[model samples]
Target: MHNNEILCRLLAAATLALGAAGAHAQGAAGSWFGGIGVTHIAPDVSSGNLSPPSAPGTQIDVDSDTQPTIFIGRMITDNWSVEVPIGLGFKQKIQGAGAIAGVGQIATVRTLPITVFAQYRFFEPTQRIRPYVMLGLTYTYNHDEQGSATLNAVNPINPPGGTQIDVENRFSLTPGLGVTAMINERWFVDAQYAKSFLKTKTTLNTGQTIEAKIDPNVFRLAVGMRF
Candidate 1:
């Protein structure tokens, strides 16, 4: 009789667990959610020049080397959402040689990056964990690279001088993927990765052009509460 009683209790417990899970799932349906996350960007380099005012007989490589970033996202439905993030980033050493004296040397540049994304979740809304993929557009506002450049000239006394050059703003397309795990009715965590694939052209006041390929790969981690 004791063994039968134990079996009955076990079945009852299982039934309760299932009932709770069903209710949780139902509660999640059609609910709106939003989250904030932090991300680390990886450096992406541009190959050859594809834009005009090309630096004659010069080869330059531009790399996006920036700091951590923060992003916000909103779920529009069970499987669809939109995300927009704004952050700041810097460029690594710009190296090249030819036209200008400091043509091949390393210089630094700063940028403001803004992105908008559309995402689609793969799992059911009721589940505690969901995986998703996204694609979107990114815009970058580049500040001038201010550094002294040694001018190419004849005579030591009149040695070519160096001056500062400011670059322009650029835009591009960015895409990525991510996953979100629900911890409870009101809390969740997420991890994501994304990359930008586009080219940008920056013209200097001196009529010199810097062709940059804006390619940034990033990783993000965040914690959030869903209302």
Candidate 2:
């Protein structure tokens, strides 16, 4: 089975168990909460051609990344809340694919995904375990794109004079589901899974472009405190 599938099952089972025997409290109305955790981003990339002046099937691939993150939120009502997630950035490796399979790495880029979610909690505030659904908007900013030596040597579209890449910023719609299990009156554990409907274009300094679908799956687990 896929790793993601396995994780889903594990989290679901844990949530069910917690619902029967867990500690006190909840994110009651007008309350504030915050947490620190780690997140994993896996991009399901659908690559595109490098536009004219390149190999017939020149394409690219993106790898996954993990980073530390923080979350802060306010419960507007007993069943409604808003949250913001923050992270330093995610560094991803860009590699050769399709017709240029052996070319190795093409470039590296760092990205920051900014998002805000409006969520609705399920079950009563006094419940030990609660499930939630959320909808969010994200703005992705990409920077520090540096091409590799392999890319320079295999500059299929242009002469090997050191090519630099720029990936355009994008906005995407995000949707998610999660479960929160209170450990005590002041602490809780939260697990969530979300997906972004995302796509972007990469432009080369040599005047070439490639559009790719980077619909990334985001997974998170956090330990938090309520006040």
Candidate that would win on TM-score: 2
Task: Report lDDT per candidate.
Answer: 0.58, 0.87
Put down candidate 2 lDDT per residue, 29-112, tens digits, no spaces.
Answer: 999999987888888889999987787888999988989999999999999999999999999999999989977888999999
Best by lDDT: 2
lDDT, candidate 1, 1-227, per-residue tens: 23235334433433343343322331143455565555555546554442333444444555434355555666677788887775666554555544433545545677667789998888777776666789988777767575444322211122234434565666777777766665567766667777888676654444555565647676666666666
lDDT of 1 at 19: 42
Clashing residue pairs in candidate 1, if any? 96-103, 96-104, 97-104, 144-166, 144-167, 149-162
Superposed Cα RMSD, model 1 = 12.8
Give per-residue lDDT, candidate 1, residue 35: 55
RMSD of each candidate relative to the true structure? 12.8, 2.1
